[model samples]
Structure formats: C-alpha cells, structure tokens
Target: MTSPLSEPADDVIRAALKAHGGLDRWRNVAYVSADVAFDGVAWNTKTREHPLSHARVTVETGEQRTVLTPFLGADRRSSYSPGLAAVVLADGRVERARSQPRAAFVNDTGETAWDELKLAYFTGFAFWNYLNLPFLVARPGFAVEEVAPVKTSTGTWQRVSYSFPREIATHNRVQAMYFDEEGILQRLDYNSEIFGGQPTAHMLSGYETVDGIQFPTRREIVPRDQDGTPAAGPVLIGMTFTDIEVVNARA
Candidate 1:
C-alpha cells in the first residue's frame, strides 16, 4: 500500500524505522526511564552558571506524561502533561506551573520561580520528544517531505523536512532532520521560536540499543549561522542518557 507521505519521504522513513527497529516494536513500548547528565549554555542560562547536573527522567509514552528530577541541589521534581505542569518541592508542596509552550523563545529576563519551573517543563517535554524520534515521526499528523540531499564532512545526507501539529512537543512546528546512508539520524535543524527564533543545529550520536530500539545517547545543540553552518561557540545544550529502561506496558 502506498504511504500517505511522499514517495521519497516514505522510503527514507521506512529505512529509518527499520534501522531503529520496526514501528510495531516501538508501539509496544509503554514507558521509558533514564539517568541523564545535562550541561550546556541553555542550562547555565537558567541556573546562573551552575555546571553539569544529574537527572532522572521518566516518560509515559502512551499517556505523554514526562517527569524530570534534577539532582544538583534541591529534592524536587517537575512533571508535565498535555495542558498541566507542576513542580513538587522537597516538602511535598505541589506548585502549579504555567508555560506558554509555543511562545517564541526569548533572552532570560530575570530568574524567577515561575521562569525556572517553565524551563523544567520545557526541558522535560523536549527531551521526551527527542528520546523518541523516527517513531514519533511516524505518528499521524506529521507531514514529511524529502528535501534535496546535502553533502557534509561525513557524506551526503538525505534530508527530510517535517511539519508537526501544534500539539506536538517540539522547538518549532517546522523542522528538518537529516539521516545518514544507514538511515541513522545525524542532525536536526530548527528555529527555536521560544528563544526568539534562534536557529540551531542539533547533532545526535553515540547510538545504543535498548529494548529493541536504537537511541542516540549523546546530543549536542549549537547555534546555526545564516548559512546553516554551526556557529563557533559553546554548545547551547549537551546531554547524555544512561541506564535507559524501556518498559512495555503490554507485556
């Protein structure tokens, strides 16, 4: 049967899915939990130059609930769902957090409780979406189109442009993903509307298989120059995930 996506787009998508384990196996996954180390300019921007921190992240894929616990200092946890978000403090106080997720990204005005909480929600939702790629692209409502191939230092990469529904958690509604010849995702390009339309080039590497799925353990995001080249500067956001556990609710 012909796919709903363009022929070239569908071919690349199928190749990517097969390389990362089939769609059927991914659909069977219920939840994923991981220990992650996060560091970068983005974190520093939020925490007044605080360095790398360990975090425990959990995502209920079926229900789209994401929770993140940062182990740098306070004993607190942040959780986000479709329209609601909350931060649980050490004393078991639940603070209602509000975020305009789709708003354009802006420079840090000043650190406030609500701003910190909103960052938590944004990071949690962003990582959850990042951890589940290609698979997430296969879901309905995403429009995929094949773009002209681009030659990088590595080789020619097949480019796929995506238009996501507003409800999907992502930096922007329109983004581009590049895949290697083996169908592994190499780079992602998007404008962070929230950060005032900052264009970024996010590179994914260090692939590891967990529960029949291939996931990139290391991610590095940097600002992109006008020509789409990575700008020379500290990484905007860098992260590595370990101790990943994908739980199958259907099992």
Candidate 2:
C-alpha cells in the first residue's frame, strides 16, 4: 500500500511505518478516535480532577487537532490546536479560548496548579502529538537520526533522536523514540518544558490492531532517571485506550 509520499528518512523509519500498517495506509487516514481512561499522580500535580473518567478522544491524523468530549464533568467539550485551545459548548459556542496556548504555561512547573484552559492545552496538545507517532517523521521539517539503541532486561531496542520544527507543540522539540526489533514503537524519552523540564519516559505496550494500524492499549508515563532509566517513582500518567476507530481520509 505505498502512497505517493516520498520514502521516509531511512530503513528504520520505514520499518516503523510498516509495522504500524504503512505510510500509505496512514496517508489515507483522517483521524483516530478512542475511549480513553486516565489515572496517576499526574492529575494531582496539575490541580485537575484526579482519576479522569473515560473520555472520548478524536485526534486528527494529518495535523494537530484533538477534541475531548465532556471535559471534566461538564456538558461541553474541548478543542485544541497549537495556536488555540478552547472549552467549547455543545452548540458550537466557545466557552473560553486561549491563543498561543503554550505561552500560557510560562513560569509553570509540575507543582503549579492549572486552570481549565491550561488543562485543555496540555492534554489536547499532548494527545495530538502522541497520536501522530512515528508517522509524523514522514512529513517534512523533521530531522531524524539513528541513535544508540536502548538495552533492557527484555531486549535491546533500536532508537532514534528526532527534531521537528519549532512550531510543533510537543513534549519537546528534541526527543527520542525506541522501537522493538519488529519496528513497533516501545518507549519515548523527552523533557517536558512546561513542567520545568521534568525528565519523562513514555513507555507503551499491549498493542492491538485497529483499522490496519497498531496502537498501544496501555501507556505508562513516568520520571526518567539521569541515566535514562525509568525512575522507581510514581507512574506519572497511566492511560488505557479502548474502542478505537480510525476514520479514513477518503471517507
């Protein structure tokens, strides 16, 4: 299912895409929607509601767009882009919106309490970036370079350090992704600038296929030690995704 897009940066990148499904199948996908449940000390740190109940998320495939329904015990939802983050009403009215959303996090650390807008920005921005995954590398303006592989008790994982355009709202512009030998994504490393550069490791597992793509059903976000090991601390954010549906661009 090769599409018209040019080849990815290298064989490793291509292998990742093929493991997911393919760059071509990804090209025809418009969005991915799922039922998400979240828990962890993360909510307490941000001053948001702890133990978020299930929420429906729809994230765009080709760009940064994420919508979470019934945001925090309300009838309204939230919509997010790099430029704007909003609490939107059922009838298409915006209850509140913040432009240049990332700037609003200035001077904030993980210890700082957050308002709804900040919550929306961070949550939506993160999911948009996360959902895009290795596929994002296929697009322009991303610099991908193979890096030293990460080894663990189970096996060694091939890794790559990548940089994207400055405008993208991600955990960090420079980050690393580790893939299993089969080319499936396994772990991610980055420092969250909004939270005082908290070293983070996002480890993913329990893969299940949906609409020709592989998605991790379980996610663990935790603090990374100085040596790049997952610190023996809190599972900062534990997520489980279910009821996933991928919408095709052609549809």
The prediction achieving the highest TM-score against the true structure is: 2
Compute each candidate's TM-score over C-alphas: 0.86, 0.94
Q: Find the 10 residues in a row with the least total lDDT in model 1.
A: 1-10
- Give per-residue CA lDDT, model 1, range 98-160, as digits (tens): 555424234434332225556665766787678777777776678889999889888889999
lDDT (Cα) of model 1: 0.74
For each candidate, C-alpha RMSD in Å? Answer: 4.2, 2.6
Tens digits of per-residue lDDT, candidate 2, 125-202, equal 888877888798887778889988888877889999999777678878899999998999999999988878889899
| The 10-residue segment with the lowest total lDDT in model 2 | 1-10
Candidate 2, lDDT over the whole model: 0.84
Candidate number with greatest lDDT: 2
